[model samples]
Target: MKKPSRIVNFLYRLVGMSYVHESVSEVREALAEHSVGTVAERWARIHAQGAEKLQHPLDFQPGLIDLHDEMHDMWRYLVALRNQASRGMSAHLADELEEAADFMGEVLHHVGLAAEATIPDASLDRGPGSTWINIPAPPAL
Candidate 1:
């Protein structure tokens, strides 16, 4: 199996964010299945290619930037869930799955929208279903 740090580095490169050392640690501690490697690599390739075309901006899907942001957010939550599992802390796995479902839903929802409809509402939240659980922030951050 690929190590967590490597998986995170791959995601960071794919997600249009500066790669950080901590992301690897976050992955090691947070993720369980760690079977999303293929998807992560594909996303990274898309992101890196998108970034290369930034200067000739007309060819890009303008919402590529927002996609990167959402990707980063997804990684952040996955890392948290992984960490929670590591520490024997209580967590609602259902909520974690719901959050993932919601994020993926939003991504697909906007994929075919008109350019003018691409902007996401700033007040959007990342919790599952309707209820938001208040988990304490990670100590390292």
Candidate 2:
């Protein structure tokens, strides 16, 4: 694969992973900032939303998809930040940090959509296309 393709694949994978991590951490962090009581109430409401979705099929919104993309972008930006930070120059990150921060803002904006369970199969790009199967038959049946 080409370098750009590889990079894009890396970003997509990173985003999926981050989605799971952030979802779980948010509940904890939110509780830390607010109180357990308030967080518990929010959790209950979120659980109800999940149950409703399971009970009804056509109620999904575009916001959830947008949030998925934004969260993915945030993960990509974070990977970029880590790479930039490893370059060993304060000036390097200084230039890239603003963009990363902007991406982080997007993640925060779509915070509620992040899933607390397993990372969904939704990917950043069209995933690898279906592969063909090969069969070997008898030479002369």
lDDT of 2 by residue, 1-141 (tens): 122354676787887832232464665864575656766778767756654544222223333555677776776777677667767767666556766777676666555444322233455436555333332221221
The C-alpha RMSD in Å for every predicted model, in order, reads 16.9, 20.7
Candidate 1 achieves a global lDDT of: 0.53
In model 1, which runs have C-alpha deviations exceeding 4 angstroms? 1-27, 30-46, 54-58, 61-91, 114-141
| Residue 9 displacement in candidate 1 (angstroms) | 20
Candidate 1, residues 22-129, lDDT tens digits: the string is 575666655633435666667667667655644432333445546656765775676666566546554566466557757765665565343323324424734443
| C-alpha local distance difference test of each model | 0.53, 0.54
Collision pairs in model 2: none
**For this target, which candidate reaches the highest lDDT against the unseen true structure?**
2
